[model samples]
Target chain A: MAIFRWGMHFDPLAHLRQIQRELDRVSWPWTAGARRIGGGTYPPVNVYESDAEVVVQCEVAGVEPSDLDVSITGETLTVKGIKKPLPREEELNFIRRERGSGEFTRTVVLPNEVDAEKVEANLRDGVMTIRLPKKAAGKPTRVEIKG
Target chain B: MAQDKSVKVKTTVSAAEAAEDAFSPLVDIYEKDDGLVLVADVPGASKGDISVQVDKGVLTLAAEARFDVPGEAYSRTYLSFEPGRFFRAFALSDEIDRDRITATVSKGVLTVELPKAEAARSRKIEIKVLE
Candidate 1:
C-alpha cells in the first residue's frame, strides 16, 4: 500500500511561474535554423540587492571570457555570451545531453538605480559576478525625528 | 563488494524518503575516445563541498550549495536560489573501468570521467598467415 500526502500548502505564484516557463518553451519560433535541443537560454542568472550595490551572478561554465559582453542601459543590465560546445570526434555519440549551447542574452531590470560607470565584473571557475554600485538617490535616507 | 557495503551504510534513506527541497542538477554526458565524460551544473557548490562516489556499478553525486545572507534585507525581483542539497545517481554498465574513474569540479560545474575497460576499447587487428 502507498500513502499519499495531501493538504500541502500550495503556492499559486509558483504554479503560475511553471506555466509561464512551459508557455515560453512552446512559443519559441521553429523557423530559427536547425532546432536546438533544450534551447531557451544558455546560462541562468541570479540577482541580489544590497544597500550598497546590486550583485548579479551568472553560471557560464565552459564559456570563454572573451566571448561575453555586459552592458547597462538605465536600470537594466544585459549579459550576452556564447557557450561553445566541447570538441569531439566525428564518430562520437552522446548518451545524454541536457546542457544548452549557443548564443544567449539575459536582460534584468534592477529595482533601484545603479552607477553604471562604477560597475565591476569578475569571472571565476565558470561563474561570472557583476557588482553595480547603487546610486546615491537609490539609497534609503534616514530622517531625524525632533524630540 | 566491500565498497558496495560502505555505500549502503552511507545512504540509509532511500531516494523516495529524501527531503522535498532536494533538487537535481542539469547534466550533459558525452562519449569520447578514452571514455565517457559527465558534466553537471551545480551552482553555489564549491569544489571542496562536492562529493562523487561509485559503488556496485552505481554512481552517486551529492553536494550542497552555500548561501550567504547579506546584512540588510530587501525585496527580490527573481528569487531562484533555494539553498539545499543536490543529489543524483546513475547506474553504470560493466564496460566501464570502475577503478580508473576520476572527477573534478570547477566554477560550479562537475566533470566526471569514466574510462572504458580494456576489452571495451576499440582496436584494429591484422590477419597473419601461417607459414
Candidate 2:
C-alpha cells in the first residue's frame, strides 16, 4: 500500500485530528453532560467587525504575555504561545488534570482588508484582544447615482 | 500528562443548572504535600464573578464569563467560541479540610487550594536500631 502523495506528506495523526475536529464542531450545539476536556483548539477566539476596525478576541487564560507572539501577513493573523505545565509534574500526585499545556499556534483569515500599522494588541485578565483598523480603501464609501 | 479525571470524582447537575447550559472549564487537580491544587481555565471570567463554595462535602466552581467585543458584529465569515456561565462541581472527600480552602484568579485562570486535614496527612514512622 502506498501512503505517498503528490505534494503533501502522509500524516495519519493530522488526518485523524481533522476528523476529530469536525466531530467536536458538531457537538457545539449540545452542551449537556459534555465535559469538553479533550483538546479542541487552544485560545478560543471571537471575531467581530465594525466600520472602523475588525477585532479578534481570544481566551488565553493562564498564558503569560511574554510567552505570546501575534503577527499578521496579508489577510491572516497568527497567534502563537506556550502554556507551560505546572512546575514539577512528576513530583505531584495528580487526582485530575484537564487543562492541556504546550505551544499552540492558531491562524485566522480576516474578513476585511485592515491597516496592519494600526493594529493594537492588548492583554488583560488572560484575554488577548487584537484590533485591526480598516484601511482607507477597505472602508465603504457612498457614491452618488448617475442619471 | 495529568488530565482531568472525570471518573474518580462524582458530579451532579441539577435540572435548573442544566437548563442554564453552563460551560465546564477545563480543570486540573493534583495533590501537593499539604493539600490539593485545582487549576481551571475560565477565560473572560472576572475574579469577582467567580464563586468557589463547599457545601455538604461538595466543591463547586461557578463563574459568570463575560467578554468584550468591539463594534456591532457583522455577518461573520468565521467564528470560534461563545462566552457563557462556567460550572463544575466535585464531591470532596473527607480528607479535605474544607475550612482552609483558598482560591485565586489570574488573567483567565482560577487556582484553588484545598488543604488536607491533620488526620488525613500521611506521616512516616521512625525506625530505631539497637546495637
Candidate 3:
C-alpha cells in the first residue's frame, strides 16, 4: 500500500531517512566505544592567564611549527595543523593503532576579548605557545566611589 | 582509569640488541625568523644526556629513552611506541654558523637552534649621503 499523508509536503519518513544517510557519511571520532582511526589526533592543550597576557600551550609531537595554522576572532581561537604519518612498510601488520593521526583542529573559547592584531604564536620543542593580550574592556579595572 | 603496569612485551630483538637500533635518527629542516630551528622528538630522554654532533657539515644527534619510573608487574602489553630510543640526524649548509648552534631539551622534546652566519643573515645597510 502506498502511504501518502500530506497533500504536497515532503514525506516525513523520507526526510528522516535522507538525514540519516547524510549523517552516516560524516567522519565521527571515537568518543566512547570502538577504536579510533585517523592520522592526526590533536595534542593536549593548556590555557592560562598571566599578568598581562593569556598564554595557551599545546603539545604537538611529531609536528613541525611551519605546518601549524592559528586564527583568532572575538573571543575564540582555533589551532589547526596536520601531522604527517611516519612512512611504514607495505607488509607490516599492526595489532592495535592507538595513536590517532592526520589533520587535527582544536578550537578554544577565551574567557574575555583579546587583541587579535597583536597576537603572537611560537612553536619550540613540540610545544606551541600562543600569547594573546587582553583588550581594555577585558582587563580588570578599579572603580572609585565618591561618598 | 587504566592501571599502570610494566610488562615485558615480546620483541624479536633482545634488550642489548634493541638498544642499538632504539630510536630512528633523522633531522627535519625548517625555516624560522632568524635562521632554522630543528625539533626532534626524543621521548624518554632527559636533559644533559643528549648530544648534537656536527662534523664536516653533517649534523648527527643522539638520545636514548632511559626511564626510571617504576611500574607494577601486571598484565601489560606494549607496542612499537612504548618509548624506547630516540635518534635523528640532519645536514647543515653554509647559511648556518656551525659554532653558534644551540640545543635544549624539555619534556622529552629536543630543540636545536641554528642561527644564520653573519654574512648569510639579512641586514639593513645605511646609504651614505653625497655632498
Predicted complexes: DockQ each:
0.21, 0.40, 0.03
lDDT of 3 at B5: 21
| Whole-structure CA lDDT of model 3 | 0.57
**Candidate scoring better on lDDT of 1 and 3:** 1
How far off is residue A40 in model 2, in Å? 1.8
- The CAPRI category of model 2 is acceptable
Flag regions of model 3 displaced more than 4 Å. A1-147, B1-20, B25-29, B69-72, B125-131
Q: List chain A TM-scores, every candidate, in order.
A: 0.64, 0.68, 0.59
Which of the two candidates, 1 or 3, achieves a greater TM-score against the reference? 1
Report the C-alpha lDDT of model 2 over A60-114, residue by residue, as the tens digit: 8888999999988887788999998888877878888778788989877776678
lDDT of 2 by residue, B1-131 (tens): 74331211213323334424577888999988788899998888876777777777888888777777553554343356666778887888999988788888877888888889999999888999998
Write candidate 1's Cα lDDT for A20-85 as tens digits: 656665775332221122233446666777677888777676677899999998878889988876
Worst 10 residues of 2 chain A by lDDT: A1-10
Better of 1 and 3 by DockQ: 1
Clashing pairs in 1: A125-B107
Native A-B contacts reproduced, model 1:
0.40
Provide chain B TM-scores across all predictions. 0.77, 0.79, 0.67
Q: How do all the candidates rank in terms of lDDT, highest first?
A: 2, 1, 3
